[model samples]
Target: MTARHVLLLGPLLMLLGAAYLLPFLGVMRWSVTLPEPGFGQYHAALSDPLVLGVIWRTVRICAVVTVIAVAAAYALTLIWVRGGRTARTLVELCIMIPFWISVLTRAFGWLALLSNKGIINGWLQSLGFLSEPLTLVRNEFGVVVGMVHFLIPFAAFPLATAMRSVDERVLLAARGMGASRTRIFWQIFLPMTKNGVLGAALLVFVFALGFFVTPAILGGGRSVMVAELIYLRIFQSPDWGLGAAISVILMVTVGLLLGVMMRQNRGAAR
Candidate 1:
């Protein structure tokens, strides 16, 4: 890069850093010093079982969502890359269309599909598959479903971008060299796209960690996540201190995960 490029990029980097850092600094101050002083809020955040449980639930749900989204995205990307023009266009449209719709609307749609008297249960009952509703909505299962729906597109977009860059001739050559389909994918395609998959997984997991509306609407009060917990602390309890503490913890958790991901990527590159 030229000196002129560095000069132009310096201010942009500083601006971006300030944008991200200022709010976090404020949160850190508030978390430690609000509602009196010292690290009381942090202590509360760490010690409270309810708070810990919510954090754990958020991590667990996000992990599941990330796994499902990444796996499904990789499979879909393979199809999209190998497919004919018409098929590729159709699948790409299907994957991208969800992003245009509101998350709330999508959550509502899932509600309709998973509710006790909704389409799924109604269909199951009609077919004598079950005598009653299968307890799909208003639970962990509902939360995961809604999260997966929202995250799948995010995972797919990146994986598709990566897959598009893969060399078709190389894959064909591997097959010509008497490599099995599974062997070719595991040894060649998977290694080539590993970075993108990891990047997408981290992206999806972080976004899922901070998710609010879907869990609120679908999980109801039963399965609370950290974001919902933060909301309650800020508005319902009028405890800005605790809210800030939770926010700081959440941000730090994401930062640590992101740092780990970066290190792994660097190691992989090396």
Candidate 2:
């Protein structure tokens, strides 16, 4: 509140600006100024078929990953909320263990399981279940599996916070009135956690949009997404202007999603 307090915070504020804000502004500048300037890069990006395809694939994959992650997290949160202490501990460990693992490690683990010559296919072949291996890795299916595995924790913790806030007595009362178990879950229990579910879904979807490692590794360059595309443009192909423009588009998309999430959270508080 005092000038002394403001002075105390000044160094930290400057450090943050120098570290994050300046770099962000530089990226924004490169999008317009690089490759002979103007907004020509944006125009080319919008009209280019390859760019359009990559953007569409990224959005579609992220949507699928978000839906699956949120649903799976909701189930896991239910167990954590209602199960015994031992079960809660088990759930916590399951979620947190994967959360702490490196994304690259997890991607390789999935690759080992899903690849044609990998564990799953080999096991199936040995048992005579199939003459050939299923096409699992290096495609959209493999990318989805890896993304969902990585995102489940991001979706679960927020949902647990929401679910824990619900009044157990309300569910008990509904049960006392002879409400069917299905009815109670579908109508009462789920509605109580709706905001949390929405919040988790938005969080997962936004994170999925920027995902780079798992998609790149599992996809084997076959299932390219926006982040991977950005990398190829900047590093592999040396097209800084196009890469920066794509980065700007991704940043704007995330910003709009966060703005919507904030407005929804405020409305829910009311």
Candidate 3:
């Protein structure tokens, strides 16, 4: 609040403004000023069937990824909270190993494993499980698998925190009262971790919305999401105005989701 405090914070604020704010402003400027100005680009992006379809697919795929990732995370969190040291170490390794790997590398790894002639199909064919390989890569299924693999760690951390915060005495008391494991889990444990699960879902959903590399590499241009579409519009097709318009729209959508997440956090705190 003092002048000295303001002076100390000024440099950091200026650095953020220069690094992040300015480029964002430039994108916002291009969205409206290019192609003779106005909001025509926004109208065009929204009205284009291809654009709409890409946006719809992005939302749908992200939603599915979030659901699966959160469920898997919940199970992992349970193991993390209740298991022995070896089990916990294994779970930690599983989550953190992929977390450290590059996104592009992970995508290509999935591509190799899921492609038509990939390991899974090869194994199946060798075992006489099928006459032909199943289509996995270059489609929605591959995209979802790649994304869910990427997002599980993101979902796990929050759920683990929530699970750790749960009171052990409450669970013990329920068990002493002859409440079944299933009944206690459904009635008590799940409700306590509801906020964490919701928070993880929203977080994963937002990240998945803007995913570019995984979808692009795995989808193989066959399944285009909004981010990939934006790249294609800007670099491949040379449509800066439309690309910027879509970028701005994507930014706004992410902002809205973050806002909802913050609101939920506040409600959970109370």
Candidate 4:
């Protein structure tokens, strides 16, 4: 509430507000009153079977990715917190490395690893385990794997920070009281970190919902996310109104989830 703080934040807030609101307003107008005008696009976007399927697929994939990423991150954070310095540093480096790498590069790396002539298939073939290459790339499995790899770091960093905030003395006291490790974890650790877990899950879910590059590269047209569909509608079909409608839907859905998360976080703090 200082004058200096207000002066610095005022212009920045204005710029951010304009940046978000302008395009959003444009999209909203197009969604409700474009092409023929007056809600036709929105109605079609809601009632069309293809659109509904794409939306459902996007939600389903995001849910699966969120579950896998959050579960893995929780276990990894526990290990990282308890690990030696060297091990924790190595894990941290592994997580950071992916974040710095380009999504296209990561997708290509996954293709190289999962393709028929890739290392995994070669190893299996060498071991006489399979007569043919397994289908890993260009499918739901590949999409999930690549998405999880990208999202795991986002999930881990937040949860790890939350875990570190927990008082070690509290855990020690639980142990001294003859509580089992599982009981201590369930009763103490999980409840304390619930907010962090919820926040990470929301973050990962939103990111996964809007994911385009990895799914496009790895899915190979087999798995179609809503983002990809929007891209196709705009650039391929040149149906700007339909594409705008889809974009509006995505923005609204993510915005509502974020609003709920913020409310829940505020309640937790109180």
lDDT at residue 25 of model 4 (Cα atoms): 90
TM-score of candidate 1 versus the correct structure, residues matched by position: 0.89
TM-score of each: 0.89, 0.96, 0.96, 0.94
What's model 4's TM-score?
Answer: 0.94
Clashing pairs in 2: none
- Lowest summed-lDDT stretch of 10 residues in model 4? 30-39
Candidate 2, residue 132: Cα displacement in angstroms equals 0.6
lDDT per residue as tens, model 2, 1-270:
999999999999999999978987998899999988799889978999999999999999999999999999999999988889999999989998996799999999999999999999999999999898999999999999999999999999879988998999999999999999899999999999999999999999999999999999999999999999999999989999999999999999999999988987887778
Residue 167's lDDT within candidate 4 is 87
Q: How big is the positional error of residue 259 in model 1, measured in Å on the Cα after superposition?
A: 3.4
**Residue 166 miss distance in model 3 (angstroms):** 1.0
lDDT of 1 by residue, 159-213 (tens): 8767877889999999999999999989999998888898889989989999999
Q: lDDT (CA) for every model shown?
A: 0.90, 0.94, 0.94, 0.90
The CA lDDT at 109 in model 2 is 95
**Clashing residue pairs, backbone N/CA/C < 3 A, model 3:** none
Could you tell me the TM-score of candidate 2? Answer: 0.96
What stretches of model 3 exceed 4 Å from their correct place? 1-9
lDDT-best of 2 and 4:
2
